[model samples]
Target: MNAYLTLGSVALFLALVAAVAVALWYRRRNDRRTHSLHQLLELADCLEGDLKTCRAGLQQAHAVMSLNPDLPAASEQEARHAIEAGLRSLLQQRIWIRDQAPRASQDQLDRAVSNMIETRSRLGPLLKALDQAQHALDDAMREHIIQRGPEA
Candidate 1:
């Protein structure tokens, strides 16, 4: 009877250890998933901010371009279209994150985050160029007005 009791106690102890191990594994898995989600959310936020900035810059460019009808608008229009497309893509990404992030694997989330980072990096130079163009346009307009004088 004593041997049986000892055997049962050993089995109970093993079961408890197994339970703890499983719990730890689950906890770690959840933590990893949460971390990935947070990274994705943060990237999305940054991308949104960058897109907004680009949109505003485009608006300023448009306003500047409006003053001079001789200026070619095709490029500006193309930039506007690109910005709109980026916004749409960002929205889709947000929706995906909302609906599928929980089920998404770590590799998938990492790849998404990497892609966004690459996009944002590419936008940086484009934004810089946009700003320069706007400034140049403003400068040219100023020069034109200055050359024409107030009495004209």
Candidate 2:
């Protein structure tokens, strides 16, 4: 009876130890996975913020151009150049994001890049028009000032 009891006690102790070790291992693995997922989410958030800022800048430039109607020839040229530069930068940024982003995010980045590229292509004429409008307005204001004489 004593021998049987001692053997059963030893078996029970070993079983408990194995169960504890397995639980610890599983918990550690779960924590690592949770941490990795959080990091990915944070990265995604940052990328989205960058995209929003870029979009806002582009929109503001568009709005400014829209408000002006008879800008000078030189001003039109400058605006076109600026627009081209912005478009090129956007294209490069899109390419970088698409390449560096994780597979899960690549599609979203790619679509955004495509849209931006298309918009950029379309902006050339609009930018020229805006420049022309702004320059014309400036020239007219200058002429009015000159005609009015220096000061009262």
Candidate 3:
């Protein structure tokens, strides 16, 4: 009878160990997922900020262009289209992250984050160029108005 009790005690101890192991494993998995989700959310926020800045720049450029009929608008139209496409792509990515991120592996999340960083970096220079172009257009418009006189 004492031997049976000992055996049962051993079995209970093993079961306790197994339960702890499973609990730890689940906690670690959840931690990893939380970290990945945080990183993706931060990246998405940065991208959204960049997109908003670009959109605003484009709007300012359009406003300046509207004041002058002679200013070429083909490039501005192209930029508008590109901005729209970027917005659509960003939205799709957010949806994907929401729906699939839990099931996605760490590697997949890392790749997605990397791609977003690359995209955000690329937008930096484009935004700078857009700002420069807008400034140049503004200067040209100012000169044109000045040379023609306010009354004319």
Candidate 4:
């Protein structure tokens, strides 16, 4: 009888240990998932900031274009910089969405990537506009300079 009790006690102890091990593993996994979610949120924030920066740049470019049909090359350069930065941010955001989105479907991921690519695509026209505006500005500046004969 004593031997049977000893054996039962041993089994119970082993079962308890197994339960503890499983709980610990589950807890650790949950922690990792939480950490990943936090990282994803940070990536989203970065993406948002990039978008805002790009929007501001576009606004500036538009204002310059509206105010002066002949924008300086420098002004166009600033717009280009903003567009590039925006593109980079979009790419980074897509990467994060692809790699870290929790249980995201492949179709969903593909759609997200496509959206980001589309956003990047729109920049081409904006960039062209900036270039054209800059050229016009430069020509205007040249014409003005000629008229002023270096006095203005």
Which one is best on TM-score? 1
Model 3 CA deviation exceeding 4 Å by range: 1-32
Better candidate by TM-score, 2 or 4: 4
Across 18-54, the per-residue lDDT of candidate 3 in tens digits comes to: 9999999999988977887898889998998888889
Cα RMSD of all models vs. native, in order, equals 3.1, 11.2, 3.7, 8.7
Greater lDDT among 1 and 2 belongs to: 1
Q: Can you list the residue pairs that collide in candidate 4? A: 70-137, 71-137
Angstrom error at residue 81, model 3: 2.1
Candidate 2: tens digits of C-alpha lDDT, residues 4-78: 999999999999999999999999966655554444445444444444544455454445544544432234446
Candidate that beats the other on lDDT, 2 or 3, i.e. the better one: 3
lDDT (10s digit) by residue, model 1, range 1-152: 99999999999999999999999999998898898899889999999999999899888878777877877774777878988999999999999999998898888988888898899899889878877887898888889889889885
- C-alpha lDDT of residue 33 in model 3: 76
